[model samples]
Structure formats: C-alpha cells, structure tokens
Target: MIEAPLGDPIHHLLTPEALRHPAAAWEPFRHREGLWWSEVLDSWVATSLADCSAVLADADRFCSDWRKLGNDVPDSRLTVQILDSPEHTAVRAQLVRAFRALDWDGVRDRVAENVERRLAAVADRAAFDFMAEFAVPLALDTIVDVLGVHPPEDHRFPVVSAQIVDSMDYALRPETVGPGRAARAALAELTGQWLDGRTSGGLVGHLAAHHDSGRVTTAVLRNSLRVVLHSGYESASRLLGNALLACLDSPGSLDALSGGVDDTALQELVRYAGPVQAEARGCVADTEVNGHPVRRGQVVTVLLAAANRDDRVFDDPHSLRLDRTPNPHIGFGRGPHACLGAPLALLLTRTALGALAGLPRPLRLLDQPRFRRNATLRGLERLDLGWG
Candidate 1:
C-alpha cells in the first residue's frame, strides 16, 4: 500500500543513497504493484517475490542480454552466465561435468585453513577492517584456488580481479568509465597470459583442457575465465562481509548457527542477508505480470532483496531468524540462470563464518560501516570489526 514518492524512478532506485538504505527506497513499492516502469532507464522494476519468480520462470518472455542494456562487451565467445536457452543448456552440460569432478570437501578444508591463518594474524588487534583483512582475501584465495590460475609472486591477482569486478558495478558513473576500460584491458591481458601456458589444475585448466581437445575455442576459454573471475569473487566477497555483519547484529542467530545449524539454517542466513540483491532481465515479448502489461524490449529489474523480505511470503520478514522454515528466498536466483558457484559459495561462507564464531574474542562491529556502491551486488565496503 506504500508508494515511492513520484519522481525519477531510476535516480531513486540506482543511486548510492538507495543502495545503502534499500529498505527506505523499497518500502514505497513492495506489495502494492509487483512491477513499476523506470522512466530514466526505461525499464520495469519487479519488486516482489512472486513477480520475480514469475519473470525468472518465463525466460521466453524475459530475455537476458547485457548488450541490450548498452553493455557491448563483444561476442567473441559466450560464457555460461551470458548464454540462454539451447546454447546455455549445451555449455552447462560440459561445465556441470567438470564442476562435479571438483573436490568441494577438499576445497572447504583449504578454506578453513586459510581463514585460520588470516584470523590468527589479526587476533591480537583490537580492531581491523574485515573487508581487507578477511573478506577480500577469503574470496580472492578461494577463487584463485578454484580457477587454478598461476602467476609470478609479483603478479597482483586480487588487484586485477577487483578492477574487473568493480567495473561491473551498475552504479558506476560516467566518469568511472575510464577506470572501467582500464580494468577490462588489464583482465584481457591477464586472460591472454593465462591462455598462453599459465595453467594449473583449476577451472581455467578444465577449460584449457577443453580448448586443447578442440571441444571449445580459445575465445570461449578466455571469456569463461574472465566471467568466472568477475562474477565468482564479487558476490562471494560481499556475502562474507554481509554474513559477518549479520552475526554481529543477531547474536542469537549467530549462536544458533554456531552451535549446530543445518543446511536449512544456512539457507535462511543467505536469504536474510545474501550478497546479490537484484537481477536484471529484459522482456522478449509482450507480457502481463501482476496486472501490469509489459511490452517487448522493456527492461525488468528483479529486486531479490525485496523478495527476500516480502511479508506475504516470510513471517516477520524484517527479523533475521535462522530457523525460519519454508524459506524460498531467491538470493542465488532460480531456474536456468541460477548461480553455478553456489555450492562453492556455501562452503566458503559456512567455513569462514564458523571459524569466526569459534574465535576466542567475541566479534563486534566497529563504528561507521561503509557499503560498496553497487546496486546489483549488495555488501559492505569497509566493515570494521573488533575482538577482545
């Protein structure tokens, strides 16, 4: 029944202010009408659970093309995330096989080891930037380990990867375009180097194996690496930061999880404070959703954060409850476009959070939290934390 003030929808929706305080911006449009047309971007914003699910399911009506949104990154080859329909299905089949072969339990053990090392170094400090000290490295190392990319000791993988991820921030201003271009160029160079013989037993190696066997082209191998590095680290890093913040805020929930939380509890944590908050989709044909008529070429922004907190679906939606049952949150998305690295992400989060919970000094959030200026991937930029 609440409504956003009558104004430029895009400005209100995509600005840094809105992202930092999403609940305020979201309140105006939550349950009234599932979708609203953004005049600035000329897109329809879907702000409810049911509507988002409907749009995601009807991929025939809603297409997933970043190019249509003016992101002309070229089509030398397609990554699994960018592809749709039959092509997507084929590529996923090959990827799933390789993905299945990965030793995730082994991966979790490595993550626990890394987190312990990182935490031990900072245990003595009264306060530290969790983003830099913990979250960033946790995400970066896990990704590097998974992809099996190797480089000289002097090589800055995290720096390059951060550039690629930050450039994709939908909230990036026109002035930031220069940096974005530079980041893309850097990633391209890195991809080229990796393609030119820098391979270990990682995802890149798996793709390289396919490339050598003539199953996939050089372009496909390169683009897939680029996509994985960008998408994989961005969301997971944010989730790490967010999950830590969630624990600091909800001691009860954290205690419940730490004691002996099951998969369902972890799912609720992801639902309550997941990294990815929204997803972008474009309409392929005329369609009707929740009484609103959408035409072809129209953009629809699905608010996953809003959906997670939908009162219609979640009881006491604003509160964080680890034991909340029947929680069908779309944090990782749904259907064909769902996140491929979800299992890895879960392992990383569970391991990292579990390790932090076991720390001797109780973790506490420091003053002045900073949020990243990204509407699509929601997370803190600088989460200061302290322990005894």
Candidate 2:
C-alpha cells in the first residue's frame, strides 16, 4: 500500500492564488509526481500526464459521475457527459455521427457572418467585455444553429447556457445556485420544445430521428441534447475567449500562429491555452495507481491544465512556444472518451483567431481576465479587450 503523501494537499500544492491563477499556480507541481488532495472539492487531484493518462485509459477503474461533485440538481443526467461504459459508448456514437455529418462549411460561413455582425454592433466602443459582446453571442448563435432552437429574438438561450456552465464551478457560492437552477429549467423547456418538431436539421433532429428508430429514447435524446449544447457551446465559448486573450498577452506567439506557422506551432497554442481544464471521474472498483491504493467509490479529478504543463512532457512548460513539437498534450482528452467535437472546435478557434489577427490594430487586453469558478470546465468568464 502506498502511503498518502504528507502535507495539506491544497496548501502544499494548490493555493487560493493558484486556484484563481491556474497557469501560475500549476508551475510548481507541473512535473512533480503523485496525487494531492483538494480541500475545495475534498478529492484527490492528479496533475501529471502519466497519472491522468493512467486514470483516463482505465475507464473501468475510474468512472465519471458529475453527482460526485455535488451536482445533484434535477435533470442533471440529461447530459451524456455523466454516462460511462456501454451506455456511454452507444450515446456517444450517435452524437459523434450526427455532429460529424454536419455541414461544416455552412457552419463556418454562418459563424463568420455572426462574428462580423456582432463586432460591427460593438465596434464603436473603445473597449468592451469580449465575453459578453462577442464570445457569448458567437457561442450562443452557433449552438442555436446547431441545435435548431428557435424562439423570439429576445430569447434567453445565452443567459441560461451561461448559468448552467457557471454552476459547474467548484467555488460556486450558494447565491450561484439560483441562476444555475434557472438555466437548467430553461434548457429543459427549450429541449422539450425542440423535441416537438419546432426545429430543423440540427442536433435535435438527429436525436429525434434516432428516437423514432428506437436508437434512443425521448428521455435520453433530450438529456443528451442538453448535455451537448452545454458542453459544446459553453466550454468552447470560454476557450475561444481565453485563446484570444492568450494571443494578446504574447504577441510573439500570436505572430507565429497568425503567420501561417506550421501545424506544430498551432498544436502548441492548443496545448498551452487549450480550454477545458480538469475533468472528473469516479472509481468503479478497487485499483492501485503508481503503487498507491485507489479504492472503489472514490472520486478522481484529472487536472488537464496542470497535466499539459507537466515539465516531464513539456520543456519551458509555462511558456507558449508555437514550434513546440512532440506535443502529446491531452487538450482534447484521451482514450475512448476523447472529445468528438474536436474538428469543429478546431475550425471555430482557427477561424476566430484568424479573424481577430487580420484586424488593422493589434487587440489589447483591457483588464486582467476573470475565469469561471468551475474547476472542471475551465475558461475565461470575462475578458475585456479593445482594438484601434
């Protein structure tokens, strides 16, 4: 039996400062081996790629349960993200097929139009919160198009989506639950309407078609759709926001990316600033990791942000080098559960970055960006920026 490492896991490893500033906070433990406890979640946190890879690959050993993190709100399981194994495989396959078969060129054109329109609407301002003005709408519109959701122009999709995503934060205060509940309710209602055929050839249509063929049930379809919308839109939106900020923070890196740097360079940016930080998994049965005893029913959280920065895998782990090769970073995760939306996400990020870079004046970060409090889905909550 491997004895627990001595020290207050949170204090010895992660500090409040680190929790708030993950990039800086993760520097010390990036390459260090072993698991540490998180007072915030009262669970063991794995920061190394090897450990994360070990847990992710052994899905039977480490299960994924959002409820383990206290996300027991009603309709929580509607999202396919919480499912595992046989059920997970079936649902994920259906989702992947539908998502991949989407009209990507059409989607890209629509996104570009949306970005231009939104930016024009806000261009008059010298500086504004990019999250609210650009990223949120871009994400919301993309999801609305993908999910085929249609409501009044004054619809609340964006607000509700933000609330649901925000509720996943580990540091969520009691006050935050109200908004989260509202978001869940809104999503449930919207998903129900979509199920009724008010939408078109979007995620809803795919699920509905599958439901009619006995491929999926109405409940599973609704829940899965909601989960996809939440994961697809909210997380990607935050990542785009952060990636833009990262580019602005380091112009040299941005230049490399914009100057048609090779795929290797682009891969580094994705590794260095790829969004979606820590992912949660629950142990299904007793197992030993790195000679340490991992009992069944215990929760394990894989810190992607920390893992990507692990010195064992990356040199100058903290710095963003577009040319960094042998980049085995798990930005999109690994194993059977790897993100199915990776291609779409890459297209969206690439387009957004390319658009921002072409602007006449360089974009400037107006303030220290704020991060969403959720430990699992990491990204910027608000990023203020301006361009001349």
Candidate 3:
C-alpha cells in the first residue's frame, strides 16, 4: 500500500462543497478523460460511464474483497458487501429469497400510513422540517416493521444511526473513527434485542429459520441484522428526501409523479440524487481500465454518481427528464454488488410521493435545503417545507 507523505495531509474528492452540491461538484472529475488517483484511499477512481460499468460487471477481475490490497476492512464482521463471489452468491441468493418474501404491496401500504401520520402531526404548523419530522421516522418505522421489531416507536434507532453515520464517512473525515466506532457498537447492541429468533414474520422470520436450520449462527445473524437496520435506515431516508428535492426543483416533475409510481421516473431521480456515489473494488489480477494498465493489488473505485451523468450515456446528463427512456443509469449499480436496499428505497419513496399528492394543498419548499456531511451517502440534514 502506498502511503501519503507525513507532512502533506491527504485530500479527497468528497469535500464539504461536494457533499452539499454533488452534481456540480463532480463535474470537474467527470471532465477528466479517465481514471484519477485518490491519495486518501491510494486507489484509482473511475469516472467515465463505460469504465465504471465495466468494473462493476466484471467482478472477477475487480474483486469486492479489498482486504487483499492491505487497507484494514471497515467492519471486522463479515457482511455481504465485501465477500468475494461464489460465497457472495450463496449468501446473496438466500438474502434475495428473504427480500422476495416481503409483500411489497403490504409494505407500501404501511409506508403510506407512516407518511399520513407524519403529515397529520405537522398539519397545524406553518412549516415543518421535512427531514426530521417526516423522512427519518417514516423510513425507520417501515424498516422496524420489516425487521419485525417491537415498540416500533423506539427513538433510539435514529439517534444511534445518526451518531454512527460519520463512521461510513471515514473516507472523507478521518476524525469519525472513534465516534463512529462507538455509534456502531450502540446500534449493534440495540439491534441485538431483535435477535432472539422469536419473530416468525417479515424478514426476521427468514433469519430465524436460517438459524433454526443451522444455516447461520446467532452472532452472524446479529451482525447481519445490525447491518440491515443501519444501512437500510440511512438509504431509505436519504433517497426519500433527495428524490423529493429534485422533483420539486424540476418544472412539473412532482406532478408527473403525483398520482402514481412510475419506475422510469424514479430511476431518473435515482440517477440524479442517489446517495451511493462510489464503490471500491480491488483488482484481483492485472487488468486494463480504458487501456490503462492497473496492476494487481491496486484498487479501482467506480464513481457511480459520475457515470449516472456521463454525457455519452445520458443526454442532458445533469438535467432531470422524468420521461427519459432507455435509462441505463447505475444509481443502484450493476452486477453482483449492486445495492440491496434499492427496492425498499423505491417502495418508500413511491408510497410517500403518492400519498403527498393526495394532500388538500400542494407543499412548497420553505427554505434552501442543507446536506449532511457525508461522502458516499449524500443526504439532506434538514429540509423545511410548508403547505402555505
């Protein structure tokens, strides 16, 4: 692993400005013809649409198990994200089944209910902080239902999730290491409450069955559940707020999605404001990215956000066209390690938007949106909106 000089503090592409306005922030990086080196991760960051797609598709050449490249794995517990193929496939197959087992229609209805409750709570207010009052709790409630946890009203979940958020931002803010670790431990302990293998419904039932059949151990199950809670909560909340922010900004975009959920329009929103920005893959064998040789043991970070707006792939790459067809944006990525929570995000957002459309009066942005300090999961910290 190459190291930065002691005197020169390393810098990264995900700066504070980038986190706030990513679409414009990533413009310069995308302008670069090909792979660029990240001094922080000591890896080549792929920017072009073709290059990012190629890396994600050919997982064998670009392995997800980045540990071989010598950077310490973020979480010692083995989660599906970094596992190599065959093993990843086996685990993923079971997870796909568990996900498929969900009654999406039912889940969508519950999300709608959560949205109504939130909206009703702020009915008398002149304005409400959308991110805090609506987005966060709605997503958390739906996730708790899916996980089959009780006292679904627990406030600690979001509090813990918020604290550890910086942990995932270690790539951008190294100071998050200690606090992030503490937050993760607290989240895991709280999530462990649901690991009793008692719930026989929703996603937890599937885990309980796996435990009963000796397919997975209790410790692994606890880690997996914790990952699901933390990851699922953050993804859904951010995607919810970001999508609405984009829709409201674009002329007639929200109305186009007013009455129903259009998958194509939703995909465009994902491309425009998807939280996941980059994925790091370790080069298993020597390979050529855009004809440039990348030695084995080196890492290639695929910039999904940049590729989503690559002009060669999407015309008017920066604009949101709800009607755009043949949308091949990798907002959820492609191939083996594509986002697992994409379906949940879509369901939550679709239900929320559809419900909001039924309101007696249309909502308007009360103030400029502010983003949380995050690199990968770019999201809003607060978004105030009012019916007046």
Candidate 4:
C-alpha cells in the first residue's frame, strides 16, 4: 500500500518518527480548519477541538454504528461503543449500573495494595521497566480482583489483551484482524460463563443478575462485560505508562503531584496522556462540520489526540499544567457513547499516582520513551524508569 503524502496527518500517525514524538508531529496540523479529506483512508479527519466536539455532540447525524453506512461490524464490536440513541441509552444503563454498584472502597484498597507491592519489589533495583514490572501486572491484578474471576492458571489475559490492542490498529495493518477476532471470541466465551454465574461473584455476577431479570439479553450482558474487561485492563495499563511519561517530560510536573493527587491535577494528566487517539463515526444524514459538507454514509474520523493539543481551546496547549481548569478534553470521549469506565479508570489512576507521590525519592525516566504504532490508541509500549 502506498503511504499517503507526508503532509497528511494520517500518514505520519503510524510512522516510527511520529510514534516516538506524536505531539510534535500532530502540532503542525491542529488548525481551526479542523477537517481534511483522506483519499487513502477514504475518510474525513476532524482535527480542531471545537470541530471534534461538534461531531461527537451531534450523534443524530453521525452514528457510531458504521454498519448503518455499509461497514461490516462484527457482533463482538456491538457493545455500548457502537450503539446510537434509545438502545444505546438502555444498554449503557445496564453496564453503568454494574459500574456504580462496585465496592469502591474495596476497589481502592485493592489497587493500593497492588501498587505498593509492585513499588516495593522494584524499589531496590538500579533501574526497571515500569510497563512490564508495574503497569501491566497491576492492571491485570486489578482486573481479576475487580471481576472476581479465577483464571485457568494460563496467563492468557495479557496475551489476549495484546491481540485486542493490535486489533485497534488493524485498519492500518490488516494482519492483526484475525488474531483480534479470535481473541474476542475466546474472551466472549469466558465472560459468558462468568456472567452466567459460573465464575466467582463480582461485577460479572452482578451483571448476570440483570440478565436473569430480563433487563438485558445474554448477548448484551456477555458482550458488554467482555468489552469492559478488555478496555478496563488495557486502557489503564497504557494510560498509566503515558501519564507517567508525560509527568517526567514536564519539569516540576512530578513535584506538583508530590503534594497530593488532586482530582484537578489527575484530570490534567488524563487530558495530557490519554491513550485514545481517534474514533470514526458514520454519517447517517447530510451534515456539515465547520461549513464543510459531509454527505450521508461518509466516514468522519475524529482526531481526538490533535484536539487535545489544539491551541484554539487551550492556552499554551503544549505545556502540561497540573491545574489546568475547565479541561474539556474528549479523552474518554463525549456524547451518548462516552466511556462507561471513566470513573473506574480515574479511580485507578488517582490511587496509583497518590502512591507514587508518597515515595521517598523523585521519579526519574531512565531513557527515552518508546510508543506503540497503533493509530486509534496511542500509548507507550516501553517506559524505563528509576524512582527507587
């Protein structure tokens, strides 16, 4: 496949240079114009913060379920992520109820336990890979604890999660499609059993109760749980890595947190380091973004990463301000399909960062940060650090 021209933001999105330094790469294209037509991807890319917000806010004209626009979306992808209005509202409620019903105190306690244990284990080391040693394991441990499910002793969670993350990048590289599908199938089956009361009682069991009461279908509960499980673990792991790197890159950013992990500062971290980069919505009716006519059935890609850095909405948009107020970044997204796990993800990050703040020494980055080449989800694949 011939790459799109260098000037195209989509072209540089997955390149080695751009992946390592995406903020700089994206900075040049974040204009008030906000929209670009990409023949290679056959989609309209929305860049400006205002435009991206407009597209997400008006779900009536732009539908998340591209199947309406002739794309073949798999059943596995049919959770709250793709649903439109009325149905989206109901299905989202089922999942949100489960989230709200969580033992929040227990959740915080468990996350703190894992963070402290991991920090202690690596405290004596001269240097360590934060991704491998801390973020990944802590994410997995929290998943099992929160879900209250016992794995078959096969260490398959991370393996499957990797396939799913790769799948997000599949549109750019077709090779990952198969493994992504297979992993989803395997995960769906496991979640099915868990949601059917075959596994230990936790979030799955709570959701299964909803299914039993005819509040939701088996497919809805299982698929929704599966999606939550995948994103809950993978998104946290990636975001932690990204947020840490962001803190270290900005002088005194870590010191600002040494006082305490305030919600305002944590949110600034979310805006600065969120892993989500883009999401495509199909046009259900004729609409125009910033006076540019978008025909029905056309694909509109929202460049959320670019929007986060758009100077139109943020002052000194490139700087990391721990107390940046009124931050309206679409990191967890917006609209009827906003992220259902936003609260949980925030809780996990807030807890983790709070622990780091109490460490006796200053956090240090051992080397340059390395990022994954995924287009839709941008995050670090490797982060070596020393705070011991």
Candidate 5:
C-alpha cells in the first residue's frame, strides 16, 4: 500500500488570494504522483487529471452525498446531487429531458433583457461592483424567472442562495452550519410552494405534475428544484464574473467572442476560467485510483481547476483559446453527476457575453475586487469595472 504523504495540511487553499493564484497555491503538490491525505481537509486530494477523472467516474466506489462526508444533515438520498445509481439514473433522465425541452431561446431572451436592464442601471454610475450590482442580480433573476418563480425585486433570494451555497464548503464552522441548514429548509418550503398545483408553464410545474403522478417522491421533486435553484445561480454568477475578468484581461478573446463564437468556444471559456475549482466525493468501497489505494468512507477532492490546466490535456492549458475543440475539461464535472443545469448555464453565459461584447474597448477596474472566503465556491464578492 502506498502511504499517504505527510506535511502541513493545505490551509486556506480556497481563499480569494489562493484561488486568484491557483498555480501558487497548487504548484508545490503538482508533482505529487497520486492521492495523498490532506491533514487540513481530513480528506485525500486528487490533483492529476487521470486521478480526478478516476474518482469522479467510478461511482460504485465513491458517493456524492454530503452526509457521507461528515455533515449531520437530514437524509439526502432524494437530492439529485447525492443520489446514486438506479435512483440517480431515473431522476436524472426526467430532469435531463425537461431541461433540454426548455425554450432555451426564450430563456436567452429573458436573460438578455435582464442583462441589459442591469447594465442600464449601472450606466449612470462612475463604477460599481460588477458582482453585486450586476452578476448576482442578473443570475438570480434569470434563473428564478425560468424556474417559474417570481424573482423578488430585492436581495432576499440572493441572500438565501448564497447561504445554501456557502454551506456546501468543506470547512464549516458550528455557527455556519445551523444557518445553512435553516436556509436549506426554508428554500425547500419556498420551492414546494412555488410548485404546488401551479398550471403556469415552467420547469417547476412539470416537476410538480411529475410528483403528483406518483412517478417521483415529494422529497425528490422538492429537492430537485432546490438543486436547480442553488446550482443554477451560484455557479452561473461566479462564472460570469470570472469570464468577464478573463475577457478584460485578453482583449483578443473579447474581440473573438464579440464577433460570434460558437458553443465550442463558449465551452472553452468555461474550461479556462470557470468558477468551480474543486469537487468532493466520498469513497464507498475500497478501490485503487490511478494505482493509489482509496479506502471506504474516505473523502476525496478532485482538483478540477488543476485538472483543467493539466499540461497533458490541453495544448496550452493556461492560454485562453476561444476555438479550442474537443476540449474535454471537467468544469461541469463528469459521469452521472455532471452539472444538470449546464445547458441553461451555457445559454445564460452566451447571452451575458454577447451583451458585454457591445462595451467600449479598454474596460477599467474602478477598485480592487474582493472574493468570497468559501473553501468550495470560488467567486468574487465585488468587482468594480467601467468603460468610458
């Protein structure tokens, strides 16, 4: 058996500072061959592309439920993210079909309108935090509207979503857990109310009918809606912020996108600067990953960002290539647990970028940005930008 490496556990690896400079944070361990125990995380860290893919694909040997990862939460089997095998397969089929059937053009139109409105509001200001004043609101409103719920004109829904997303972080304080759980429960109740016998056209109504037909459990229906709401906005908002920053950093990329890049190019942008840095899975059975042993009930974190930048995969992993084809990055994850809202996220992203394409050259940063401190979610809290 290969022994786990010994050293100071990587602390604050997900801090804004660390995430902003991933190479500095991960360079030391990039040379490590396989899975090694991280004392800081009390979980094994998988850095290489091969190792991360192995952990994500072999679901029989690993679990995705949070309860398995030491969280004292309610039963999670009904949740789309945590469900395994047969159940996950069935539920995901329904969700996938429903999501694909969504009027993506309509969604894009709505999101584009929202984006224009957000920009109009900030057009008068000298500069504003792009994250708070723009990305967050646009994401929250667009997703909520598509899900058949009225987006509150204030910060209520955004606040709730942020709380739930933050709770997913590995390092949770005692104080944080209580609020997170409460927010989750509240969200469930809110989602159920929105879907209760509503005939209005939307994904939630279809799910409600599915629930009423006895095809799906109440828990499954409610939690699936919860998953969409949580996953849709949190990741999309951060991705918008990251992608915008990336475009500003590379004017040629902005020019290429402005001139109309295809879905493949949009995907390349996600691969290059997507917000998700890492993902966690719990090992269920003894298995060897990339020739390294991972025992039952052990947590393994796949460094997705690292894998995206792996030299063996992309021709120039660090360079932003708009036309990179066959780019099989795990930005949305892989296997059965791949992001369910990926299509919607991509649509929204395309619309957002298209809107940004109209901005004047030489976007300016009004102030230094601030990033959230959550270990799992990498996003900016504030990014002040302007173009005059």
Candidate 6:
C-alpha cells in the first residue's frame, strides 16, 4: 500500500465516513515516522503515544491555547483552555474544588434514572436511532441536572455547543468560523442569565458561591462554565456511543460487561475506543520533541485516538480486551489539562452500560452506526438496534 501525501486525508477526516471507520482512514499513515507535517493542517501530526504524551505533558513548551498561533478565534476570552500557568493553575484549582464538592452519589442516581427513562422510551421500537433517542438526551439531561441549571427554554444549547467545539477541528472550513463565534456569544449570554438567577447547589450555585467569596472572577466563572458545560455536555455522550459500538462489535464483551467487570475493563474500553480523537496545542517556545525541532507559534495536533492504538503500548492493540491491565491510555488526556470531568464521565458511561445490559438479550444492529460529520469529535448520530 502506498502512502498518500500527509495532506491528502484531511478532507476525509472532516466527513462522517472517516469518523465511522477511522482505521480505514488512518491506515495509510500507520507507518509514517514520528511526526508528519500536514500542509493542510499547517502543523505537525503526532501519532505515536510517546510523542503525543510529550506534547501534552509539557505545557511550558506546548500551550493548549491555539489562538497563540495568531488565528482570529472569536470569543476566545470565554474559555480558560487558552490560559497558561500560573494563571491556568490558580483558575483550575477553583474549578477542581467546585467539581470535587459535587455529590457523586446523587449525580450517579440521577444519571442512572435518566438512562433508564430513555431506554424505556425506545425499548419496544423495532428500530430507533440510539444516539438521538438515548445517548444525546441522557448526556444533556445529566449535564443540566448535575449543574443544577434549568434547561434553556429554546433547547439550542446542544446545537450551539456542538458547533462551537466542532469549529476547533484542524480540518475546519472557512465558512464554519463565523457560525462558531456566533454560537459562543449566544451560549455565553444564556449562561450569564442562568448564573444570575442561581443561589446555591449544583455547579452554577458553586460557581456563584466562589465568585461571592472573591476566589474566582466573573469572567473566569463564565469562561470556565462555558468550557466545562461544552466539554461535559458532549465528551461523555460521544464516549457512550463509542463504548456501546465497541461492545456490539466485539463478541461476548457485552456479556462480560453485563455481568459486571471492574474498572480495568472500563479503562480498557476507553483505551480501545477513544472518543476525543485529537487535540491541538500551540508551541509556546522553541523545543525538541523526539529529536524533531519545533519552533514557537507552530501548532501540534496530537492524535489521541491513534496513540491509544499504538502497537508499542498494548498487546493486540486493535482488539478490545477487557482484562488488559496497566492500560496507560491517554483517552482523557494527561498532565495539567487532563479532562476535568473524567470521574463524572466514567460514572455516566458505567451507568449507561449497566442500563444497556438490562435490555432484552440477543441484541442486533439494524444498521451500521452513523457518525456525525466532525473532525475533532467522533460520535454517533444514529445507532439502530433491534432485540426482538
């Protein structure tokens, strides 16, 4: 098999077809050296686990805020992801406290209830879009409930939030940039209203309290909320879709999951079916990674999904084995910017899987799962299943 030029596959990555079948899309680059410079991305693609980890862990050299690359990122102020430490550290501490104070048991109960309620609605249908009917609703409702915020009257958060995050894709077209900025502005105003009305309890309440105490600023609170809500709202939902598809594709794994496996199995599942495909980081200073020189102002896209499948890291990397131990997958990322909602995501996924196990056995896919057209995020838009 001949390797196409590095830039040739990015257009494919922007489509649902590439997301639905990543192996086929990425197979051409499987043997490419450490970092392939993609003229399309105008950045280097880090596919090895070690290289990706190096880029993510060294924030001093590689920054999370891609705006530093000089692109006009509208509403960039509405997020902390762009801030470097010690600013990032102080703000992150406040958010971490707020997250830690959340009642996990209560959140878990609500999530499980939400999962059951959704499953009940489609339990008898001959065929249903599992993502639309179950996964998306479950994730949205859980996010609202956990944050203790009333659902927006317009129900536009899902669409807007997705667009905002999708705009971060390395393969984004010029036409998408404007809409993403507009979505960010709309979401910020909506969240501001929610924050103003809040008193105590939930995430909004905690943030309000922190703001009152003068520990966190209003801008920080708003931006942090925007980032958390957007990420929390979508990441787990994508993971849920991916994990379910993983079980369905792997024979007998559903039985093992239904019978209850330990956290190791869950970890391995994430290692095998990573949801957050790739993350872009800007080079903060001239540095060397894997002996390759990287200059300041350049962007590096770390392929997390690809790294998780690196043959050097796992035995039979392509196969999903629940018992795989010492799984050091960076599915949630690593170091300072590791996913803040990882525990919550894990709880939600475990709950969803448990609820799925309760479905009538002999489950069958009515059709192959369909993914939404996105490059930065991989998630199902429809998963048709029949159990009768």
Number of the top lDDT candidate: 4
Query: How does candidate 6 fare on TM-score?
Result: 0.93
Instruction: Give each model's whole-structure lDDT.
Output: 0.71, 0.69, 0.76, 0.79, 0.75, 0.77
Write one digit per residue (lDDT tens) for candidate 3, span 1-388: 2232232122443565666566666776666566767677678878788999999999889888766666576553455676766656756666777888888788877887788888889988999999989998788788888877764355565666776676665766778877767776666666566666477787877766665324544554566667778777899899999988887787677777776768887888899988887777889889898887888998888878888888887888879898888899898888888878788888888888877766778789998888887777789999999984
TM-score of 2: 0.86
| Candidate 6 or 5, higher TM-score | 6
Candidate 1's displacement at residue 193, Å, is 3.0
Task: Give the 10-residue window scoring lowest on summed lDDT in candidate 6.
Answer: 1-10
Q: Give the per-residue lDDT digits (tens) of candidate 2, residues 98-131.
A: 7876787788899888877876776778898988
User: lDDT, candidate 3, residue 181?
Assistant: 73
Backbone clash tally for model 1?
Answer: 0
Q: Candidate 1's residue-wise lDDT over 199-238, tens digit each?
A: 7577766655665434545565566666666666777888
**Model 1 TM-score (2 dp):** 0.89
Count of steric clashes across candidates, in order: 0, 4, 0, 0, 0, 0
**In model 6, which regions exceed 4 Å deviation?**
1-7, 66-78, 212-215
Q: Judged by lDDT against the true structure, how good is candidate 3?
A: 0.76
- List per-candidate RMSD values in Å: 3.1, 3.5, 3.4, 2.5, 2.6, 2.5
Please give the distance, in angstroms, between residue 286's alpha carbon in candidate 2 and its true position after superposition: 1.4
Instruction: Give a tens-digit lDDT track for model 5, residues 173-217.
Output: 445666677777777777777877584667776666555434567
Query: Which lDDT value does model 5 have at 27?
Result: 61
lDDT for position 124 in model 6:
71
In model 2, the Cα lDDT at residue 190 comes to 64
User: Residue 142's C-alpha lDDT in candidate 5?
Assistant: 77
